[model samples]
Target: MRVELDEERRAQLPPTWQRAFDWAEESLGGRVVAWEAQPRWRPACFFELEREGEILPLYWRGARGEWHRNTRPLEREMHVIEVFERNGISVPTRFGLCEDPPGLILSRIPGRFSLDTATDEAHRRKVLDEYLAQLARIHSIPIEEFEAIGYRRPESPEQSCLGETRGFERSYRATKTRPDPMIEFQLGWCHRNVPKDRPELSFVVCDAGQFMFDDEGLTGLLDFELAYIGDYAADLAALRTRDLTEPIGQLGDAMRRYSELSGREIDFGVIDYHTIRFALINPLSVAGMVTDPLPQANYVQYLAWYVCYGRVGLELMAASTAVELDPPSLPEERPSRRSVAHVHLTELLDPAQAGDDGERAYQLDRMQRTAVYLDRADRYGEALESDDLDDVATLLGRRPSTWQEADAALEELVLSSSPERDPEFIRYFHRRLSREEALLYPVLREQQGIAVPPLE
Candidate 1:
């Protein structure tokens, strides 16, 4: 049982990272005996160490490269975890940081990743209650404690509610390759509707509701890459998004549990606002990746995430503002001349061709999915573009002939519009986003049913 990597996955990591396991072994004064990379967009691995006749299961959590907008340095993450552990928050014991590849080494916490694997409904409720209690403890941590560690304290009520939202918007604008009216609308709407009376702030795991759990209860809260100082409602808003994928127990009941544990009144309005803001993150963080992907980039994952979460943001906006939206009717896909080529490409790149090489198979699966998306586009692309331009024409008082022209005109309108126009903008973007959703429906059907769970 020696640490090793298959040729395909090994080539994907940076040259410097090839020795990351050895570095972790040396750091811990142990021998690396076994390791396997976690199959996700980011680079991370689980490995076991042998030290002084005992074996320790450890994890090396890697950074999401500089390209990612919503990530922190590995050192900062280590410090954050240390603070959380000091404050009695359930977290893995940090071993040290790997400087070469930029990751953290820690004792592996044992548990399943989500509540979706609970033995039964009773088990799910019990684990969820325990998780909500942990969330309350997290929100209750003293602001000064985190402030002492260099987490910025919000100076005003606006900063308390809108600070993270502003940061996300800046990231989106800086990295986006093209005009995105949907993102623009969300930014404008959030800025205009910032909860002015927000007086409370806490150290929030900005990407909250991510933790590991066992039959007994939560093993540890994981992933602090996006932690920040902000309104606690932001964390609750994150749980709503997580509920879409992880099936967290009912949010309304969870809110009651959080309110009881934290001894603070829950503000449904603030949570609603944050839900809209929170949903923007999925699309924004992956915008740069989708537009200019790296060789190892999980292109289809980012594309599905953008289409699915972008639509979720708009739907949340509609519900919050009482806007009723009608899904656009798609014209039957007329197969384009290149349609047969797409079918051929999917067959050529099928994941089954990769055989037992897990990494190769994963990459092929993504390639095949890309072909499927393109096939859908070939069949329906023209009709969808026509629908989009028509919607833009309705908003801007003139039709734009091309997708680029439509995006430019619609984004211009979004920037200059007032909050009073939010309903119309939400409706327009909702219909527009639904088309993308429909195109990627085969690969991402589960995400389509995601609705913002009621807070009250």
Candidate 2:
């Protein structure tokens, strides 16, 4: 059945975005008979239509808004996909480019999105091996090929290592409204610890290990939004981060196999540094959005990444520095007067109750998640704020009644303080972020068990 959008929901789309869908329909000379929007931080939708008596599945991936942008433009993504297609890399075929709202029309890859989807061990291994080999293939592409198409090549080793991250930090700072001690401290730490002995730059997928796989093998590599010239070790480190969620077998074994295929030594030190660096991208991208998200933004998804991956960055930092961390205990749960009302709201909005209508189910799922967050916040927000104030007082020698004041004071201290105080700041921020993880625990329950795999 077609996923129909009501008039109210259709009215929410800006004229430009509405035209983007029209552009895709007109370009293909077919009506969009079935469609559903995929709501993961980015704005993407899947459309199905009968063209020339053949059902064509197409994906229309759009930008959130001009206010939030990827490192490269949308046209660049299409070009990169073409490059991958030419170089024998398995990637989704580009159908067309959407100009009005800045998006791409791509043929939907046919396979499960993760290797773990294979029930048999041998099948999983077969797919994992091919995925790693495909990753090596991506890195093996000469830097000049990418540079020929306007992709920037690093001028030096330091630039190769820190260039993209520095750009991310600048964007974070430009739009930053509130003081984030965890983000600030991590930024300072990353800036201080750029890898010196990094390998010659290669065209690495900055967010690697995302592909569609099945019994045969990987169907197509998905997403080129963050592809750029960087150290190969950065790609390996990003794979480790993906392992947290995608379950890609033993990462150390994956690294060893990748080394054999690419003929490059596995630099655990560089991987270690990059693990933290890569994880920081999550919180950095969402810090402003988490603080003040736009109306159309996926606020819960932003929060999910901020805490889940943000904790990965912190844990990696602790591991690299040999600091022992103690995750804070959840404070006593005392339900407020509004907790029952929140429970009722979430139950009413439950996606499972929406039955066969997929679009309604998806919208209900988002609303239910929001309800769960509000319920948890109403119950535990005060205790968490009090705990934060205590942590701030421990660091700054004075307690602030509100979390906002505490954040400002702690951030000022982080900016003005010396590196010698990093361990203390790290400890403090870890405890504070742990509290957030606890508060948002209901929404992020599925991701709670995800941990960055070891490089060794």
Candidate 3:
């Protein structure tokens, strides 16, 4: 049966074709075809083509540049796809880049997305686990051999971590809605706590929604456009962001499986942090697409999950009270476990301070410690005897001289601490405060006039 394109959809096509029927007929190798707009994807038109005996399906991504674009990154992605294909991986086989508007052509795989249809609980669990294992296999591919093939390593873990934190700060400031204090506090805490490091890197299939499975089994992972040599945990974080219905236990199970299969210890902490960051960042990308009333319902549900999961992850990190684990001990000295003590101190003081909440907490903690040292030096026996002097100093340092000063400082910090204005500096400030708290805080707090309150 020949497929007839709707009038509205046909109108969107270029005038090279006289009619909707002709457009489908011409596009499908001169054969009669049945076509319809893919459900839930209004921009792309899908056609099922049939000739004498062969049948094929082609998806035409509409010429909307915003949703789909031919860019350097995309071109790089296609190159990686070719590499994976050579390795006997079953991804969408590229027919060729479309000549008309230059979109990539791919051999359509046969299978419905697990997300698109309901499955039994057992099947869902199995499918989820299988997909994660598949992800592990994809990540296991060595990128060093492919380096000459235009494979670029993503920014180091430290750089990417700082970038994400900075990105969130920028987005939060730009949002029309009043920023959430809790989120701001958490970001500050993370900034003050998480360390900068470059660990092992791996290839990631940036978007996992393109993963396809057939009744036979997992068919293939798709969409390598975001593929890069980066922290594998970051890719896993992206996967966890999409999980709405399952409990953390299930996600943990998948992570455990990946670890077992890959022989690489999965850093659950890093995964958790990056997952929260993913949740925090995704809303901006999907906001415009979520405007329609019908779609907004689904988007709201997704958004709610991301927000909740993000908060949960943050709380877990906060409660854990240690940001980075101890690195392997050297022959001379054992690796030190970095404490969130400064982060805790910062949280305690931020409600009152004028600077970056994370920085303020760090500085306050440093000043208090210094004040303790200074008090000891000055022979203030009473202050030195007090175990709570650090707390007092932090609190005192945060209090405004007047209500007006507090308000002004808060406004300035909120305005100036955004990523766009000072991404590198903001990241540097946070990184410095996180790793070198004892060094950075004393000077910072002295500048703020952080003083020890008199003991009653």
Quick one: best lDDT, which candidate?
A: 1
lDDT by residue (1-456, candidate 1, tens digit) is: 234545565566556555786687677887766676565677677887789999889888877843233334667778888888888889889999776666788889999977889989998888888878888988888988888877898888888887566676787778778887777777777777888888888889888888888888778888887788888988988898888988887788888788998898888888888887788888777888877988778787888888788888888778877789988998897998899999999899988887766656878887788888899999998888888888888888999878888888888888887788888888888888888878887767457566776665
lDDT of 2 at 178: 78
Local error of candidate 2 at residue 56 (angstroms)? 2.8
Per-candidate TM vs. native?
Answer: 0.93, 0.92, 0.55
Best-first order by lDDT: 1, 2, 3
Clashes by residue pair, model 2: none
lDDT of each: 0.80, 0.80, 0.48
- For residues 308-390, write the lDDT of model 2, one tens digit per residue: 88788888888888888877788888899989999999999988877876556767876788899889889888888887788
User: Per-residue lDDT tens digits of candidate 3, residues 113-135?
Assistant: 64435355566556566676667
**Model 3 score (lDDT):** 0.48
Over 4 Å off, model 3: 1-32, 39-42, 51-53, 61-73, 99-102, 115-122, 160-198, 245-249, 284-411, 415-456
Better of 2 and 3 by lDDT: 2
lDDT score, residue 447, model 3?
Answer: 22
Native RMSD of candidate 2 (Å): 3.0
RMSD of each: 2.7, 3.0, 18.7
Compared with the true structure, model 2 gives a TM-score of: 0.92
**What local lDDT does model 2 show for residue 196?**
71
lDDT of 2: 0.80
Which regions in candidate 1 have their CA more than 4 angstroms from the true location? 1-17, 65-72
